[model samples]
Target: MRIYLKGLRIYATIPRIKDANKLAKYYTETNKELGIDVTLDKISAKEFIKTAIVNFNSMKEFHFGIYTKNHKFIGLFSIIQPNYSKRICEIGYWIAKKYREKKYGEDAIKIITDFAFKTLKMKKIFAFVNTNNKASIRLLKSAQFKKTHTSLKSATAFEKTGTHISTYVLHLAIYSDTKV
Candidate 1:
């Protein structure tokens, strides 16, 4: 899928296996500071790539390579289960360290949301954010996502260091008749 959100200075395009290494490195380098875990290590790159390919090809999910106007690889933005019969989908995105404060995340979300509404004909889109992630919360809010629900003490199998996150769900109505 391809989407252009002019005001955000970014666009979303289909991802490729060639992006795996850079994407992994970007995630590994930024997770410590960002308190997020969304990548596979170098040793797991092959498996990750295969999984990404399957998710893209079989699941009908649009995994976009988030890029800058100058064609720099910023991060990833995607909608999972895009062909859901309920007309609902979830938004997932992350930006590399250097691009965090530049509003690339927000711009990427806007583009993806627009695609979901305009192209996919989705009724609504949702996102689950950790409560501690202020930047993500701000991005969702700026995109007009309203908090619809919350889950306390959500499970985190990856955090052996005892990380417990509160999950907050934000919903965006496709037919709101308002620009995001």
Candidate 2:
């Protein structure tokens, strides 16, 4: 399936192995900013691609590729840890370094948030943002996600050594009434 936003197209399709090199490069370039705990010392793009395909097929999570209207791959968005019984889920996303601050992240969030609330029938969606990732915090706010009082301390090295994570949430009821 495909979702189109103002300057972006989001695809519910697995990325091809051929796109791995670029993705790996992005991973290498943005490791610090990504806030992932794993060390990609030897990021095997092929392996990553295979895992992505497997994960998509497993139905455990939903991953979408973010692209330009012209089909240029720029980033990824995901609805993770969905609890169907609870009607809640968490969101995750990363834009390539070159695409940072261009509002692609904001657009992608809007698209995914809509998908979660409307299609997945989720009551609420939340995102855990690194406290220091101002760009992402701003992006989430732009997409109408409000910060909750909750916070998490890093169990591992996340957010480039930053120790705290900020939680943000959006409810279906709130999103339904917003004009954005």
Candidate 3:
């Protein structure tokens, strides 16, 4: 996957082994700030690099690093195919601590969504955000993702407080081609 979308003060490109060190550093720092346990040990970083390489080399998916024009890493965004025949993919992303509320997330989402619909030829894309993550909800809505359905008791194990999450699904057909 080539670098796409160069404006909006941010650009995104596929992750590489060269990026592993930086990614690991970013993850460790962000996790600490978010009060989440840092799960990517040295072995885990190795495995993550291998998996990311495989996914990119095989054209199986695109995992992008959101970076400034100066090449400073800000966040990550990815589109993943759960199964081959499903013709469906899920979008996931996170911004660096200092980059939040800077519109980088919105820009990255627009770029990735365009890639999903045009380059990947995907029919549907969805995002499952925690119900309590109001920032994410606002971003998704601003990106034109509609509320399709909610899964009660969803994401119980992922949260520290064991909160239920709602799954928000959006069809690309309904989304307008806008800057977001």
Candidate 4:
């Protein structure tokens, strides 16, 4: 099954094989420093697309391609490792370099968070963000996700040994209270 979720400036939907080339190109062009836990080695675009398809079909992760109202491919947003019994899940996302800082990420987060709580019946949705990514930190906070804690973790390609990763959570109650 595929999902099509809409927001003010963008919409998210499951990726098709036709989208693989574009998505792969975006992955190759994007700077690795965009996210702290970004992949260290670049995978061939087709291979990455294949993996995305496998994950989606296997129910391993819910991957959505973020696009503009006019159908411009912007980036990706995902629900990771959902725990139905516990009513919880994790989220991860990234925007193309040119699309950053324009509130697209904020809108995507809100859309996916709403889906998790309302459609998927999740009680909590959380994110693990690199502490050094100020833009992401700000975006999450603006979406009303509370900072639970920060911890140092293994280095990523762009980070040093003691990189700090912060965990943020948005419970259904908080989302309900702030949702308009």
Q: What is the C-alpha RMSD of each candidate to the true structure, in Å?
A: 4.0, 3.5, 3.4, 3.5
Error of 2 at 127 (Å): 0.7
| Candidate 2 clash pair list | none
The sequence of per-residue lDDT tens digits that candidate 1 reaches over residues 1-180 is 433445358877765466767777876776666555665676576566566667776657767788788877778777776546767777777798777888788778777887778777787676766666788788888877877653222222133244433333434453355653
Q: Estimate every model's Cα lDDT from 0 to 1.
A: 0.67, 0.72, 0.71, 0.76
Give me the displacement of residue 159 in model 2, in angstroms.
5.3
Question: How many clashes (backbone N, Cα, C below 3 Å) per candidate?
Answer: 0, 0, 0, 0
Task: Give, for candidate 4, the lowest lDDT window spanning 10 residues.
Answer: 150-159
- Please give me the total number of clashing residue pairs in predicted model 1: 0
Q: For model 3, how does the per-residue alpha-carbon lDDT over 1-180 read when each residue is reduced to its tens digit?
A: 355556577888865556667677777786665456865655566677678768866877667888888888777788775334655677888887778898888888888888777767676777876677788899989888877763323321145466555566667566544533
Q: What is the lDDT of residue 134 in candidate 1?
A: 85
All candidates in order of TM-score, best leading: 4, 2, 3, 1
Per-residue error (Å), model 4, residue 150: 9.5
Q: For model 2, state the Cα shift of residue 172 in Å.
A: 0.6
Better of 1 and 4 by TM-score: 4
Question: Per-residue lDDT tens digits of candidate 2, residues 3-57?
Answer: 3444354443455566776767676666655645443333487787677667756
